[model samples]
Each structure stands twice: as C-alpha cells, then as structure tokens.
Target: MKPVNKNDRLLVHVEDLTHDGAGVAKVEGYPLFIHGALPGEDVHIHVLKTLKSYGFAKLLEIENASPFRVEAPCPVFDTCGGCQIQHLSYEGQMTFKRKLVRDAITRIGKLPDVPVHPVKGMENPWRYRNKSQIPFGMEDGRVVAGFYQPRSHQIADTDICIIQTPEADSIMAGIKHKLTEMGIEPYEEETHRGQLRHVVVRKARATGEIMVVLVTKKKKFPQAAEALKLIQELVPETVSIVQNVNPEKTNVIFGDETITLWGKDVIEDQIGDVRFEISARSFYQINPEQTEVLYGQALEYANLTGNETVIDAYCGIGTISLFLAQRAKFVMGVEIVPPAIEDAKRNAELNGLSNTLFEAGPAEQVIPRWYKEGKKADVLVVDPPRKGCDEQLLQTILKQRPERVVYVSCNPATLARDLRILEDGGYRTQEVQPVDMFPQSTHCEAVAWLQLAE
Candidate 1:
C-alpha cells in the first residue's frame, strides 16, 4: 500500500455518487470520493485518505447550491449513516442512479450497448420501505437499534429512516425501552456476550400489521418471555414475533434457529392483485412500490406467452415463479434451501397456484435432473445472490440452453461477468433495466434479459 501525499481542502464540485454511497469529485485532475456529499452540489472538502489515482474526503463547506439538494427527512440522515441519497432530490437521485447503472455496464460489460432505462420512482418516497433491519446493541448499559454511520463500524442510533414504514420507526423506541427494562443487554459483537443483535421488522402495506424478529446470539434472555409478552400487548399490530440466535461471527443471518414466539412466521404481500407470502428469510424486495415496477418491467421484457414453460432458478420462496406462473404455461423453481423450497410450495398452494413446481437442490443437481427427465423450459429466470451465477450453474444453464434467460441481479460486476458466460455459450445480451431498490445506499438491482443467439 502506498502512502497518501496530497491532503488539501479543494473547492471541488460533486459530480456523481459511486454505487456504495461515496460522492464522486474531481480534485486537481484526479477523482476523489467525498463521503456525505451529494451530486450537483459544490462543496469545499477536507481530503482524508488518498491513493495515487483516487482519494476519500470529508465534507467541509458548501460552496454552491444544487437545485436538487433537499433537506434530509431524518434528523440523523447524515450522521446515523443509514441513507446517502437523503440530501439529493428524489428525481435527481434517480438520475444519479441511472448513471450508476450506465457506468457499471460500461466498466463491467465489454460492450457499452444497451440503453439504461429510465429509473422508476414511487408516489411516496417516504415510508416506502416495507422492511427495516435495525442493528441492536448495548450502548452504555442501554439497548439501541438503528443503522451504522457510513464507513464506520459503530452502529449509529437511527430514530427515523425514511425508507421503511412509520410503524418501524415507532417500534424502535419502544423496542429499546422495553429491552432495557427487561434487563436485556443488546449483543456486542466484540465481547460476544449480549442478548440482542438486531431487530428485523416487516410490515404488510395493506394490513399495517408488523412482524418483528429479535436477533440474538443466545436462546434465552432473562426477559425473553416477559419482553415478548409486553411487546404483543404494546404493539398489537406486531403480528409475528420471533427470535433468531446467531452465534457465528460472520455477518450472515441467523435464520437457522428461528422460533416463532407469536403468530405465523410469514406475512402476505400483493403485487398487482397477485398475492405472495414472504417468510422471514425469504428474499423480497424491500421497496414494494419499486418492486411492482421492477417485476412489471421484468415481466414485460421477458415477453413470456401463455405457451411458454419457465424455469426460475434461485427462486427464493417462488416470488418470481409464482408471479410469472399465471402468464406462462408452467413454471419450475429451483432453490438450494429445502426450507425455502418448502415455503415456495406452500406459498404456491396457499395462493392456489399449482402450475409452478419447486425443486430443492443445487442448480447443478436440479438442472441436470430436469435435463435427465427431458424437461425443457422456454424461458429461464436466474436471480442469484450478489456473487452471481457460479461456474457449475452457468455450465448447467448452457447445457439446458433455455431460449430466454432473465437474470435479475443486485451486483453489476457479477451480472456482467455472468453475461459474458452466456455470450460465450451462444447467447446474445438483450435489454437491461436498472431498478433502484435501495435509495440512499450504493446498492441497486438490474434486470437483464438474455436471449439465445441463433
């Protein structure tokens, strides 16, 4: 690692935002990443960490006004570090995000070809978040739940994040207060001897019933019984309350040992008159409104007809499969997690959607199973994790050679890399649409439609 030499407060204008919540600025003919600044704003920044080509900076003073700059909704919008786009006008934020997708395609994809679609926005930006994961910790012998500030490991106490339902914010104060009264110390990762790690809350947009899951490292808190008992009484709409004890130090969720203390473990959400079930660990878009638009775009671009058979790989709980099932002749979903597969089946049965079938196994095993059984799908939708499609999976996809491949991805680099595999396997890249799932953060989702080349 080379030492940073230039650390000067330069009058630099923030031109854009990097995918991971850093503001882009050109200082002295070099790119600088200034934290806590917005695009279209000119600000004097204090250069902090630097490299040969690029550096990071701290915002010092505003030199000029950006027409799109807006006062952040949350008081801790800048400090609590939850959202980075709160300072940017919602429309301007969408524009910045569109550029992010375009830039990502240019850098990751070999060819800059597809037109990045216009970003979709919501009628109400505030309270658009359907879910909120609040990090819980013991701060000075008290329980606090919120998000961490940008780049800092310490979790900042977030009172009100603009993304989620107001109920989520209202429940935070009560959660901390009750946990302290119960003598439950929030989990401390460094010490590894606290009761709570985080509070995962979800709200049904239609019912307003919220589900709260308390994440901890241990099973039994001294106040576990009483705390939940009180929570049910205080927050009546809190339909399902559960506890997840995650002992491992890794950031992965502790969903393996989930015990529902009250109500069902899942909630119901409807996307354009079609209802779907969301389990605690199931992958559902956080922003429901954006999800409707995203799914609609995906459905539209898929161009699926009633005659087509679709395969939805990595279909967690069959969100996409069931969504597309009604339009397709039949839909098959493959998932690695058996429990999720079971949930998918149950979801399908719950909604009386029998046209969709779910299989539990690695894509390598399941895809081959379908292949050996001489089953062929006309369209295949692959929505893998940020790591994207594994080589084995990609090989299986090639072998199967579904006529159409719809890849819904969270990471652009991985998506591009996977696209290259398909390209090499005689598939041509088709239209790609970028959706802003996470507003204030650098993370965004892209729906890339892939078609087999003749």
Candidate 2:
C-alpha cells in the first residue's frame, strides 16, 4: 500500500457510512473516513490525518454523486453542528438508519438472524424538534445565541434553526436581541463572569404552549423584568419564562437554582391521551410527534393484554409507563432522577392514571428491592440511555425472567450489545423496529421485542 499523509489528495469510492454519518472509503483495504461523501459515490478527498488503522479525509469534489443525495436547505448546514446527513434525502436517511441498526446487530451483537424491520420515518421530516437549547455568546460586540460548532465551544450564530419549532427559534432570537439591547452581558466561559449562559426553549406541540429558560451565571439578572416583557411581547405563545442559575464554573447548562420569572414553572404537553408537565430541567424528548410513534411501537411490541403487570425501567416522566398503563393491569416505573419521578407522578395524576406507580432511584437497585417485595413484572420494558442498560440491571432482568422484554433504544450499537446478552440468557430476539425520532440527523430510535425461549 502506498504511504498516505496529511494534505495528500486522492480519489476514492465511498463504500459505507460510519455511526456518525461519515462516509468510508478504502485504499488497499485501509479504511478512510470522509465527511460529506455518501455511499456509492466517487469523490476526491484531501487526507486530513492518517492513522495506523484508519485515516480521516475531507471531501473535496464529488466526481459521481449518489441519486439519494439532496441539497441541505439550512444556510449554515456546513458550519452548524446541530445536524449531520441533512444533505442526504429523507428517504435515504431512513434507509441508512435501518441499515445502521441491522449492521450493528449483525456485527456487534452477532445476531445475524434477527429480523430488523424497515425504519418508520416521518411524512414531513422537517421542523420536528420541540426543544431548543442554544448557548449565549458575544460576537462582534453583540449577543448571539445558537448551537455550538462541530466539536468546538464556538457558537454558530444563527437567527433560525430548521429542525426546531418556529416559535422556539423566534423566541430565542427575540430574547437574545432584547437582552443585548438591555446590556445583559453574555456569559464568558473563560472567566465565568457574564450573566447569561444559555437559553432553552420548549414548546408543547399539542397545546401550543411555550417555556423559555434563561440560564445565567448568577442568580441576579440585570433588567430581568424588561427582558421577560420583551420576550413575552415578541412571542405570544410563550406561557412560561424561567431563570436557571448556574453559578459554578462548569459546562453543565442547568444549575441547582431554578426561579420562575413569570407564569408557571411547568408547561403541559400530551402524547396520545396521556398528558405531561415539562419543566426547565425535565428530560422530555425533543420530538413529540415521533415520540408518539416510538412509544406506540413499544406498546405494540409489549402486546399488553390488559391483565399483565409491566415494569418500565428508565421511564422518564412516565411517558411510556402511562402508555403501557392504558392497556396493562398495572405499570411501575423507576428512574434515577428524583425530579423526573416528581414530574412523572404529576403527569400520571394529570392524566388520571392510577394504575401506574413511579419510584425515584437507580433501576438496578430499585428493581431488586421491588422483586423482594413481591412485585413481579409480566413484561419488562426498558428505555435506557445511549450507554445502554447497566450490567446489574441486565442480570436482574435475566434472573427475574419476565415473559416478554421490550427494549426501546436510542443507540443501535448499545442496543445490539444488550440484546446479545439477553439472547444468551434464553430470550429469543423477535423483531426490531427502527424509528426516525431525530430527522435530518444520524441518531435513530428503535423498539425490539424479545420473548422467553421455550
């Protein structure tokens, strides 16, 4: 193989895509990852860095474009790190996501026979995000708020984001402008001195209610009332304005202190018939429309018959627990975050769902205690974080041996790894359904059905 170095330009054929949406090319079996190059396309790439095992390249020219490639509509599509694969057509994105799931299971999980279904995608794959979190920074002596650039702290200043709700975009833009006019200094991460750190906006798609959170460096915000008034006037849909004080010198967005500047601290939203109360630090899904679809798949896979007891692990705000409760005899949920448990209980009460119970603790510890207390789960449902289920939790699931296990996952690689462990413990992998919860991005959500082997 010829030696490859930085600044060496070469022509290669894109053969595959990585988990992060980067295209893969090979020269004499040596892998090279190139951004902006789709599968089955011939492109000229400039080698950015070459490693012993693989190399990184930048797409310079596409000699042959794939039929699935589409022009990204966002003006900052290239610079903004908010999304990847926006240049690919929506249909192509779905196909690639489905392949991602299948490949992960087949390669990582070593489950080649598991039936991975086609991805369930949105009819209109744009403007689906219900939440927006943009960092506040100063550029050219003016306050700017937008997402951070790819792999950097530098903010990509923009007036609008195509994925977020229009109301959220307008609200952030209005707040940034108003606060700048009020001389409210944007937070500087270097010295940790300014007042404003970040702005988070949440919109309820069903009720058209909005919640705006101003994350600041200190509790005292100068000209707070005037800025709140300006935000309210600019976006009439905003029903809640909150200030979250992060006095520490850290990268975390929210601090321990959350004060409501005006109106309620929580906003109401619904998925199907179940209602939820969303707060500033709530772990609500960013896409509600796809959430309904994703949870519906979980419900379908659970195959509740109105007589079984269901246990939902990592159930945030009882979103899926309530969905299961509608058909099951009883649903018990466990989460690590105490505030999420509070919100879950409130949501359960708001929907008049008495068949569900929520507890605040780590699932691995709490579920074992529940097991000793005679609480049994006919069906075990887990929607764990991207890192996947804890090993102790997996061991507990195997020991308890629920008749059915419905796994809802955001990361296919981790999902496959967990599924392999379950399959080894006598669970038969039935089917996997991928959902496009995040459109125009590389992330995909999936629900898998596993049955106890006879």
Candidate 3:
C-alpha cells in the first residue's frame, strides 16, 4: 500500500464520524480524519499529517453531500472551537448521538442486548446554553472576547455566538467594548502581565436574571467602579457582577478569590420545581432546559415511591439531591467541593427541604462511611464528571448493593466501561437514555438504569 504523505490531495468516500464529530475516510484501511466532512459524502481532502496507522486531512471540496448536511449559521463556525457538528442537521445530530451511546455500550461495555433509547433532543437546539465563558485577549491592539480556535489558545474574535443566550452575548460585547474604551489590557498568557483574562456570563432562563464575572490577573481591578457602572447601564437585568483574581499563570478560568463588585453574590435559577443559588464557581449545568429532561429520566429510573432512602453521589449544589428529596423518604448527598456543599445546604434551606443532608467529602470515602453508620440506600444516583465514576466509588456502590443504580454520565465510553464493571459485580443493565444536553456540539449526556440481579 502506498503511504499517504502530507499535502497529498486525494478523493475519498466519507464513511463514519469520530468522537469529536470529524469525518472518517480510509485509504487501504488507514483512517484519515477530515474536518467538516460527513458520512455518505464524497469529498476531496488535502492530507495535513499522516501517522503509521491514521492520518489527518482538511476538507477541500465536497464532490457529493450527505442529505443530513445543513448550512452552519454561525459566522465564526469554522474557527471557533466552541462547537462541532453544527453543519449537520439537528435530526441527524440526534441520530448520531443515539448511535454513539449504542455503539459504546455494544463495543466498549460488551452489552449488545442492553436497550439504548433514541436521543431526547431539544425542540429548538440553538441558543440553548445559559452559561458562557469567553476568553479575553488582545488582537491588533484591541480587546477581543470569544472562544478559542480549534485545539488552540488563540482567541477567535466573535461578537455573537448562537449557542449562548442572547443576553450573555449582549453583556459580553458591552463589557468588552467598555473595557477596551477604558484602556484595560487583556491578559497576556505568555507573560501573565495583563489585567483581564476572561469574562463569564450566566443567565437564568426562568427568572431572566444574569450574572457577569470578570476574571482578572490580579486582585485589583483597574477602573472597577466605572466598569461596573457601564456594565449595569448596558445590561440592566444583570443581578450580579463579580471579580475573580488569579495571580498564578494557569489555564483554569476561576481562582480562589471571588469578590462581588456589584449587587448580590449569587443568582437564582430553577430546574423543574427546585430552585438553586448559583455562585461564581458553582458547577451548574449549562443547558437548563435539557437538565430537566436528563434529571427527569433519572427520576423515572429511580421509581421512588416516597418510602425509600436515596444516595446522591457527586451532587453539585444539591440540584439532584433536592429533586430526589421531593419523592424519597430521605436523601443524602456527597460532594468533594466545600463551597458547592455550602451552596447545596443553602439551596436545601431555600427550598424548605428538611428531608435531605449535604456533606462535603469524596463520595468514595463518605458513602462507605455512611454505610458503616447504618445508613442504607435503596437507590443510588450518581452524576459524575466527564472522567466518570471513581473506581473506589464503583466498588463501594457494588458492595452496598443498592437495589437500583441510576447513573448519569457525560461520557459514554466511561459510562459503558463502568456499567460493565457493575454488570460483572452482579447488576443487570436495564436501559440507557441519551439526552442532548449540549446541542450543536458533540457532547452527549446519558442516564443509565441498573438493578441488582434477581
């Protein structure tokens, strides 16, 4: 077989999609990932790089187009790294995400018989994100705020983003303009010597409340009062304006110090009937509409009859715990972040929920201790991070043998792997439901239901 070289122009038939939404084409069984290509399309690609087993290419021309292809509406779609698969139609995205879950369970988990449901998609997928974290940088001696370029830290200057809420876009643009007029320097990552690093915006969909967080390189925000005045006048609905200082050089968005520049420190939002108070660093779900759907599926899987105790692992701000408490005899939540635990307790008190307990500690350590203290769980619910559940936590769950295990996951591969471990530990995989939490992007969320072997 002739080895493909860089800068080689080749015509290939696109066959499948990678996990990140790039199209796959093969030359003699050597897979070449092409950006912006889709399945069932014949495309001309310029080979960018080649490896021993696979290659990377750039889409040059579409000789044939798939019926599922659509015109991407975002002007910066090609450069911004915020989203992928926007060129594919929403219906096609749903089908692809559903297949993603199914393929992972069948191939990774080795559970071909486990039922995976069709993806629950949004009625309108665009402008669904309630949160936006735009990096601030200087381009051509002017302040710019937008997403980074694909796989790179270079900011793609954008005035608008379709996935983010309209209020967030307006507020971000207003602050960027005001700060630029005030001669505020955007953070220089290479030198770490500038003032502003990022601007994060969060909008509550139900309440129309907004929060604007300015991440700075130092504790002192230059022209703080004037900047806050401009932001408030521009976006009057904004209820919170915060400043977070990070003196150290790092890529992380938030720092240890957060101070309210104006208004309240926290903003209120709701998922279904439960209310939550969100702070600067709270791990609230970005998409509120689909969070209701995802959690609703989890609630359905629990099948609580108000007489069983439930344990919520990795419960951030008591969002899932509060939901479970409404229908269970008692609910206990465990989290690793202390601030998030405080927020959880505050939220529980705000909702007047007395049947719940929130503790700050690692679930792997805390849940086992609860079991030792004679606190049993009839249902176990976990909404873990993208890395999925910890091994020790999985072992603890298996040892406790909760009658029902409701696993909420953001990564299908890890979820499948963990499910296989649980299945081997005497649990039966019942069903999986995929939800499009981050629409117009490649990320997919799923809730899995499992039961102890009969």
lDDT of each: 0.79, 0.92, 0.92
> For each candidate, what TM-score against the reference?
0.92, 0.98, 0.98
In candidate 3, position 137 carries an lDDT of 86
Among these predicted structures, which one has the highest lDDT? 3
Considering lDDT, which of the candidate structures 1 and 3 is the better prediction for this target?
3
Mind sharing the TM-score for model 3? 0.98
Off by over 4 Å in 3: 1-3
What TM-score should be assigned to candidate 1?
0.92
* Per-residue C-alpha lDDT of model 2 across residues 1-454, encoded as one tens digit per residue: 4467789899999998898889999988889999889999999999999889899999999999999999999988888898999989998998899999999999999999999999999999989998998898888888888898888888888899999988878877887777766878899888887898988989999999999998988887768888788888878888999999999998888999999999988999989998888999999888998999999999999998999999999998889999999999999999999989998999888989899989999999999899999999999999999999999999999999999999999999999999999999999999999999998899999999999999
Task: Summarize candidate 3's per-residue lDDT along 206-300 as a digit string, tens digits.
Answer: 89899999898889766898888888887899999999998889998889999999999889999999999999899899999999999999999
Those runs of model 1 whose alpha carbons end farther than 4 Å from true positions after fitting are 1-4, 248-255
Give per-residue CA lDDT, model 1, range 327-428, as digits (tens). Answer: 989999999989889888988898888898899998777887897887788888888999999789899889888888898888887888888778888888
Candidate number that wins on TM-score, 1 or 2: 2
Clashing residue pairs in candidate 3 are none
Native-to-model Cα distance after best TM-score fit, residue 293 in candidate 3, in Å: 0.4
